[model samples]
Target: MTLSEELLMAYDRQLRTDAETPSAIGIERLGPLRLVTFAGGRGFVTYQDLAGASARTISHWVAEALAFYRSDPAIARVEWKTRGHDHAPGLHGALLDNGFEPDETESIMIGPAHSLNVQVQLPPGVSLRRVSAERDIRAMSAMQDEVFGVDASDGNADAILRRVAREDGMELWVAEHEGAIVSAGRLEPVPDTDFAGIWGGATRAEWRGQGIYRALTAARARAALALGKTLIHSDSTEYSRPILERYGLRRVSTTTPYRWRR
Candidate 1:
């Protein structure tokens, strides 16, 4: 396999499978569809490739998964993750008809963690560290929500607290300036994989170009290295893509999510 392909497999094997929220969501086989349900009242459907499935079968899979989610009142939303490389026919139309809205088309990036794990110079008065205390986590999550344009979510903070209670390898990192969070991210070490996922990266709008996020990432990379993880992966948005790209991660593929929300 080519280097990029190798990195992609590393990502699937190491990072994606260990998604605490998504991975734990047990998979349900509905014909050709693998319906995934997570703890957060979220459902997801994804397949390696849909080459063998006929259009009718593909539609059937979509309908079945939707029915599965619709039947669950607790399921607030569902995301059908599609890879650009998948050969599933008529996926777009089927999902739209099923009341799924498309999120941004994200680049499926993969590469060496060490490449981006370098020492980034943080702006003056900015500092990075990992936090576990409830107070600090609350502060961090609130800042991230605001930076990323998301509403306040106790789910994320609760997840971290849950992880801390279980002593899970998940760690929350933040960049703080003058007692306020300016940037934040999470490092998740997937079991049975040689990689860790760097997720939930956000920087306050005014804090951009200040090198805080990079420093936060660098801190996470350092933590990953200490954990014996050699690779890192993230589903990046346009805002953080260039920063990660500068660190040597490549855009290997694209991920399109079809969302079904209540």
Candidate 2:
């Protein structure tokens, strides 16, 4: 197999299961789909593959999945996560027919942890550290929401706090300038796997291209290595995909999330 195919297989085998939802409160299966309910009134759908279902079957599954989530009053919104490499014919039309709007596509990046462990020189007066306190987590979450153009909400912070309480080996790293957070990300070491995920990476507009985000990523990579994870993975936006590619991570596939709001 090609290098990209090899990496994609590793990701599919190691991450397409419950490892994808470490903090999920509940999970139900519909065929090959995992219907996951998280703590923030959010629902998510994922699976290893579609099993080559015909378009009609996929449409039926989509409608049924919506009904299942709708049965739960607590589910405020749902996202059906799709991967570009899957044999999911007509999945997009099926999603839209059920009122799901597609979000931006992201690169599924994967590579050796050590490739991202290089030293990076931060801009003057900037510092990096791991944060666990509520106040720090909130600040970091707010900064990320702002960077991503999402409205401010407690859902992300609350979810992070819950994960912190679990002590599940997820570390939050941030870059600071003058005591204010400028860039941040999370490192989650997948149990019984050779992978650690660097997720939710964000940097303030003015702070971009200063190597602070790179430094933050390097810090997470070091932590992942220390925790015995040999691989790093991320679902990266266009902003961060190029940087990760420069550090030797391959874009093995793409993921696009389709959302339904109640």
Candidate 3:
């Protein structure tokens, strides 16, 4: 197998299950699926694979999983995370049949952590730091929400603060310019695994192409390396994919989130 395939295999083996939901408030099992509940009334569905179930069986699992989430009044929305490398049949149609809408597909990126640890020169007056204070975290979250075109609410910041309180080895990094956050990301080190994930990367539109995001990614990668993580992974949008690829991260696969709202 190629190096990218080998890395992808390692990701599937180690990053599924509990590693995928470290901040989960509760989890229940349905066949091979892990039904996860987060702090913000969000339900998530993931699994190693569908266990080679036939199309009919997969459809049944989808209905059952949807019912399981629907029963909980606290769950306002649920996301079924689908990976492109899986062999399950008829999953796209099954999701749509069950009132699930597919979101944008993202590239599954993986590579050596050290490759991203290299220094990238930032624009003048731009600097990177690891944020922990509630105020800083809140600002970073809001900046990300703006960049991603989501509502700037406290749900994500609250969840992140709770995770910080648990001391889960998740680091938040940001690039600040003129006292404002221009780029940000998260580094999560998976316990007992050689991998850490760099997630939630964003850059303000005006700041794009100035190397702020690249520096932020490198900062997160350095933090990962400091924690003994040799491999890094991310599900990257098109905006960030080329930057990661330039740093030696390979596009191993694709992932699309199917959303269901109550």
Stretch of 10 with least lDDT, candidate 2: 152-161
For model 3, the superposed segments whose C-alpha errors exceed 4 Å read: none
Candidate 2: misplaced stretches above 4 Å?
none
- Give the lowest summed-lDDT range of ten residues in model 3: 16-25
Error of 3 at 183 (Å): 0.8
Per-candidate TM equals 0.91, 0.99, 0.98
lDDT of 1 by residue, 60-141 (tens): 7888889888998989989898877667788888889889999899887777778877877778888888898899998988
Q: What local lDDT score does residue 130 receive in model 2, on the 0 to 100 scale?
A: 96
What is the C-alpha lDDT profile of model 2 across 98-192, one tens digit per residue? Answer: 99999999999999999999999889999999999999999999999999999988988998999999999999999999999999999999998
- Cα RMSD to native, each candidate? 2.1, 0.7, 0.8
Clashing pairs in 3: none
Cα error, candidate 3, residue 132 (Å)? 0.6
RMSD of 3: 0.8
Per-residue lDDT of 1-262 in model 3, one digit per residue for the tens?
Answer: 9998898889899998699889999999999999999988999999998899999999999999999999999999999999999998999999999999999999999999999988888899999999999999999999999989999999988989999999999999989988999999999999999999999998999999988888889888888999999999999999899999999999999999999999
